[model samples]
Target chain A: MNAQAADKTVATMAQTRPLVAMDHVSKIFSNGTLALQDMSLTVRGGEFLSLLGPSGCGKSTALRIIAGLGGVSSGSIDWPSSRINSKGLPEGDISFVFQEPTLMPWQTVFGNVFLPLRLRGVSKKAAEEPIMEALTAVGLGDFAKAYPRELSGGMKMRVSIARAMVTKPRLLLMDEPFAALDEITRQKLNDDVLNLWRRTGITVIFVTHSVFESAYLSNRIVVMKARPGRVHADFPLVTASERDALYRSSEDYRQACEKVSAMLLEAMGDAPEGH
Target chain B: MTSSVPEMNASSERRKDIALRIAVPLVMVVGLVLIWHFGVVMSGVPPYILPSPGAVLSALIGDWSLLFPALVVTTKITLMSLALALIGGAGFAIFLVQSRWIEIAFYPIAVILQVTPIVAISPLILIYAPTTQVALLICAFLVAFFPILSNMVQGLKSVDHNLLNLFDLYGASRWQTLIYLKIPAAQPYFMTGLRIGGGLALIAAVVAEFAAGSAGASSGLAFRLLESQFRMNIPRLFAALLMLSALGVTIFAATSFISWLALHRWHESNLKREN
Candidate 1:
């Protein structure tokens, strides 16, 4: 049902503003693993999209390819008005948060968050306010002095989020960031990330294996399949864009989740088992 | 914020844990010394072969004036070589990591040097070097270099691929990534190498002195060991051996202290936990 709506909206999105476009991109490892195959995606400007799939479906590989972390063996990707830099990154700045917290464990919370700007040659003195602001955004204003080892898992993930946001990039990529957190912490972070996206209007490409999470957070959901990884279903999430606690219980959200779950099951060549 | 009762308890528990850590090690050392003393007294080994603990202690005190200068000389050489190895090893490792060709082409040479016994090459090194001091320095450097190089290479390569993706997203240059991500991430591994290298450097220094002592003009502790042995000054020989052991212990402790200082804030190696 949602696929028809997505097909219609996708055309309008492509016409008005396409922030990034992947054209039949494929990636194969030297060990002969086909992580991605003939995958094409169009990420519209300022959209919250999630690539939802099972473990080996290459959602992460797709995200990495888009962020220029991994190279495509065939086909190409294009960004609006700018080509890739010599380093394979888009000319515009990008930020990525990995599955694990991946904070420099030896660095303090403030130092970890300050890294992107520091990498761009900003001194600590000059970066102090921005670093504090990033930490504060994640509600860790007083915990800047803490080390990663001293932090709880949720807090460390927050630090990772702050580090990704420090650069104020045009694009942000996050791979299974909240998967390790408990339900309550994950919900809190989900709301916080939505708030950040609303405030910054940065384009986001999120990857996750959670059906409910993708249905709740994303405007569009890309369901992918494994073996030779490729997109199985691309559809508009029918739930409201300004989602909240109410949306989680609303009939639309339930339907969207069921729809995504069914798509995923079909993608994996399995009969859908009711949740 | 008000300190909770549980928080106060946690802090006190941590303090107690640290005290126990120190106290346990201190007690063990004293116990071992007592056992050594009693065993030697019971065995009645001749002083020339195995001096009694008291006699060795007395020799240490009586010969302090002579032994102190030799200790200082060996220490200077060990420290100098260690510093040189750290700089050269890390620099070359970074260079190797910059290109696959460079790493593949040169890594074998490092392995060859590491496998070739330093004792076997010392004579050749002495002949080529301009002086005895230079030859000793070279020997120490060769022994210490491989750990820093190989461990650092392993460290540089072991970086989380996701973190590398994060760097790439931010368009961090090779140099920027090295300083910001790779170098900081490599700390634990580098510290491991440093601890091993520290002990190896001292061993190499003493061994080099032994090889170089053939010139008979050496003033190092190893040369002193030789002179005392030749004269059958048993107590002094025991004193020299004690001094050498003391030096090794000191270097090990110093390096461990450095690793602690560098990583206690974040790495698991230095963490103090309640449990």
Candidate 2:
């Protein structure tokens, strides 16, 4: 199928099912600074969405709100309440991967991944199989007993991803999990993450400052502007089921990157002087 | 490069690193003893005023029958007091982490204990308590409790904000947070406090014994030192002092070693790496 046709099909799919709906969300900090203002977006189930913006933008703030880690000063977040059982209705199972990996330095890879389960009263013996599976999924199976200090930057992030996935959370919220990795490692992880998402069909909301990364990894990119940060533009990427290394080097990918970069520059108030 | 080579090289390098570190400290200690030995011999200082190392060793050997019992008494008091301090300090830290009101109410009392001299309160504590051992335990607990409480409070509070938010999003209850998150996070600080507290417990026991003035038939190393000094048995006094210093060293090293074993597998405090 052509790129344009694939784009139409993806958009149709997104329109059919919304997994997370944010309605005119506004966040004002205690310092009276408006971090997010009147922003609204919908993330479809099984879709990869990236909140793309420059530094100081409220992309992270928006993610935190959806994760229930932060409260919106105004507006509401409507997550997929249907997925949660009656007792767990208020909060669904979701995992967050932070910018710095943020793995507990005092825990081995296995221990870190087993933390959520351990917190829920699952014994170590019972959690071993799932923990091992998660570690294997992240390609850190051999490093399960290794401490965070012993791992390289990329390895630590793999551990973080393993930890996040161990609970099989319905929604995976990642705040630039690969920003600190070198380009090669970041590309490898991006592919690994896409594979995981494809197999599990889990919804992923990633926040990134890089337009190239958002273009490459996301089905939909929510562009944010700073200074009372809010959504400025939303760009949807067209992808095929057989996306591969060649797909990344395709003309469509280049076009998407250029388009998102333009939107980001415009959002940062550095739009071409000629308008 | 192959992964096996790096792993093998790393393990060997670690062994060499440990050897070098121990060698440097060992050499310094040997040099210090040699200097002390030569200085004492050349100066011809009277045994009463400054007993030679040989004289102290002989006195220690000669009075082993008397000194051994006193050593056992002192050690018992030190260990018992430290155990009580650990329990009290950890309990207080848990309470402090539970509620802001409780922390604000009780934290100052801990600070007051930290600042107050143990010597000044030992006599009063002895008067009030039913037994000398109980009074000594209270004195030791007072000296050791504050650092553990303060360090642990800071550690519990200092958990990575992102990790804390992750726990909150996971719907972890307060008790779950305490056991799973707060306690693990506080382990390093608590271990550090335990190391310091172990030493402080010893000091408090000795000082309390000194202040109590050998009332009971049973007496500790402190009493032995006092008796030796009063009788002008300078070599015996020096021997007791050496034993006390050795006791302090042993307590510090043993606690630190335990902390290392517990945390070396994961924590940065136990890490041997440069970065």
Candidate 3:
């Protein structure tokens, strides 16, 4: 949000460690739709990566496979920096934020944030401090007793983020978590997320269609194409200076946006109409 | 002073809204009773053929000893059947939802039972059950069972796919997913089932007793109505009918209150709209 806050987050030492790698991963849905084809990607330990693409590009499918929500038809995923579980995926060190907030309607804000810890068999008393910490991290400390229905769209998304972060996961997968929010709320959340990532040093793989958002938040962007989906372009948007409102208005940011936009258009051009 | 004035106005307006909701319904009921009393008196119908409101009131007080015991019998049967249905339906739904194969195998059987009229099966239940009370309970339980099972099944299946993915990403065990996610997610639907089943349970209990025609000292209000009709005690029959209607209304109110309690904080159906 500001130059000083961004300066503190430029400590990029954790980006080199290979965390998980997909080797020629391909997924064909039961209905015979090929969602992804021969897609290989390695997610590092602490980098902010964005899977940027249009609809049907399988960016979501790729993220799902990485999170072990879907299986590859012809390839395997390897975890180099984390231990593999019996399911052959990374163990219980991951969290996912859905496009929708996805909080339980019956639960209060605190209860929703308590879910991941509760599922892992942590007692409520033991989970109190971490739950409060997570809530505070998301700026929802005052809404601990409020139900999901009482919150605004942005606040509900904040609860979702709190829920995801409560476990102090090593990896966080966000599937366009702010896509439904208004622009102002989305921008605010982007800054908050960047700050949280900086403070925790957690790895984040964010999926998005917004060029501005991806350009602003991601250190690395993977632009994907549809029609038997696969990655078409991969690039780093590293900046020597801190990214703030000034950086956004800068010519460097304008060029980065133009570059990503042109690549997205090219990817869209490759796919058929109505995609 | 300006802010406080609007706040006081809003509070008073809210109180007035609550008062109007209760007052209008009470006024309607009073008006209906007055019309009925006058209509019966003006018609000059004999008390045996049609009892006036005053006659009915006298009968209600005069027969209170008999009617109270009968009301208790009916209430007990209704409540017990509802409890059984809740246990049976929710348990079966959970069991069926655990495996698609199990749901596919058993859901049709549940549908068959639901479609078959309870009236058609009441005779068989009466013949098979060890006691008349047991037969009445069985009929009520059968009537109440389907709505709960159907709603709960739909609720369990309706869990957001992304939330399921989030749970999977966290390596949540099946039991943990059921308890922490699926069950709470299914609550609104479960409450809906309870409301519908509550009314159905009462209807089935009374109807089953009527069909059984089992008259004894311990017989329900339905039996008292039949006995009063047979003995030309029309005023007492009206009293029993009044008690039955009151019981039905009470069950509906109680079920609705329970639903409101469970869902008012979060569910869309229970939340009050601002406009």
Q: Give per-residue lDDT, candidate 3, residue A266.
A: 91
Q: Estimate the TM-score of every prediction.
A: 0.86, 0.90, 0.93
Report how closely model 2 matches the true complex, as a DockQ value: 0.61
- Assign candidate 2 its CAPRI class: medium
Chain B TM-score, all predictions listed: 0.90, 0.92, 0.95
lDDT of 1 by residue, A119-181 (tens): 777989999998888889999999998888777889999999999888777688899999999
Worst lDDT window (10 residues) for model 2 chain A?
Answer: A81-90
The local lDDT score (0 to 100) that residue A256 gets in candidate 3 is 84
Report how large a share of the reference interface contacts model 1 reproduces: 0.81
Deviation of model 2 at A182, angstroms = 1.8
Over the stretch A125-205, how does candidate 2's per-residue lDDT look in tens digits? 999999999999988889888778778899889888888888888789999889899999998888888889878978899
Number of the candidate with higher DockQ, 1 or 3? 3
Root-mean-square deviation of every model: 4.2, 3.3, 3.0
Candidate 1 chain B least-lDDT 10 residues? B211-220
* Model 1 whole-model lDDT (C-alpha atoms): 0.84
Top DockQ hit? 2
The alpha-carbon lDDT assigned to residue B96 of candidate 2 equals 83
Better of 1 and 2 by DockQ: 2
